[model samples]
Target: SQQGEEDPQALSIQEGENATMNCSYKTSINNLQWYRQNSGRGLVHLILIRSNEREKHSGRLRVTLDTSKKSSSLLITASRAADTASYFCATSGPGYSTLTFGKGTMLLVSP
Candidate 1:
């Protein structure tokens, strides 16, 4: 499968805590992106890191990529109850316009 694989399939945390998710891919990719979906609905783009980038951050989210290991990680700081959602990592490989997404990591944040 072209899809990536995410670790720690599910997580539960209290509000204001940090949550981390990891993903690993089998093949080379041009870029890696993280997304969040609420209630099994559409996904919302969170951040994108290029193959050449080691780390990228936006708001309370931080992402790291290690091409040598074909792995990536997403971290959310000071998570809130609203942060409860499923996160996914997706990658676009060479010569492929569509992105293959990982299964997902379900996060539950309690207030």
Candidate 2:
């Protein structure tokens, strides 16, 4: 069964704007990860936030985790047309040795 599910299913934004995506999980997780996939390319790891962590940042990307609510959010600042891609949320922990990925959120950034 899938542990995580991304909300909004799709998002549309203009260049230089900010985009936000959210995820909710079903079970306890030691860590949750966000990824981006550009069309035919493979998914690229974005950030992994531990259960103990509330937030993380890398470049223009910001991620927040709330284990108590079993939810997380990803924010991309200064969105660009190049930032257009599908984002996925995945989770793994405890008895799970593999990650379970959500269906993904398709983001379209217009120039």
Candidate 3:
């Protein structure tokens, strides 16, 4: 598949701790985007780092991309209970309007 799969289907962490998730893809991509979805809600864009970029950070979130390995990782620092959600990595086709997503990593941050 051209899409990526995240390791560890689920992750649990305490408030104020850090959480990390990794994604592996089979094909080259233009860019990779990380999104967070609250329970039964729409996904909120977290960050986008292109194939040419190595690392990017947003607020308490950090993302790293390794195009040569066709993989990426997302790190959430000092996570809070509100951060509990499903995280997905998305990449779009050059002309397609749809984005392909992996099964996603479920994160639960307990207070």
Using lDDT as the yardstick, the better of models 1 and 2 is 2
Q: How far is candidate 2 from the true structure (C-alpha RMSD, Å)?
A: 1.0
Give the whole-model CA lDDT for all candidates, comma-separated: 0.94, 0.95, 0.89
Q: Model 3 off-target regions past 4 Å? A: 94-97
lDDT digits (tens) for residues 34-100 of candidate 2? 9999999999999999999999999999999999999999999999999999999999887656899
**Candidate 3 local Cα displacement, residue 84, angstroms:** 0.4
The parts of candidate 1 lying over 4 Å away from their true place are none
- Tens digit of per-residue lDDT, candidate 1, span 1-41: 64789989999999999999999998899999999999959
TM-score of 3: 0.93
Ranking of predictions according to lDDT = 2, 1, 3
Residue-level lDDT for 53 in candidate 2? 98
Q: Which candidate achieves the best TM-score against the true structure?
A: 2
Better candidate number, 2 or 3, judged by TM-score: 2
Candidate 2: stretches off by over 4 Å:
none
Give me the displacement of residue 57 in model 3, in angstroms: 0.6
Clashing pairs in 3: none
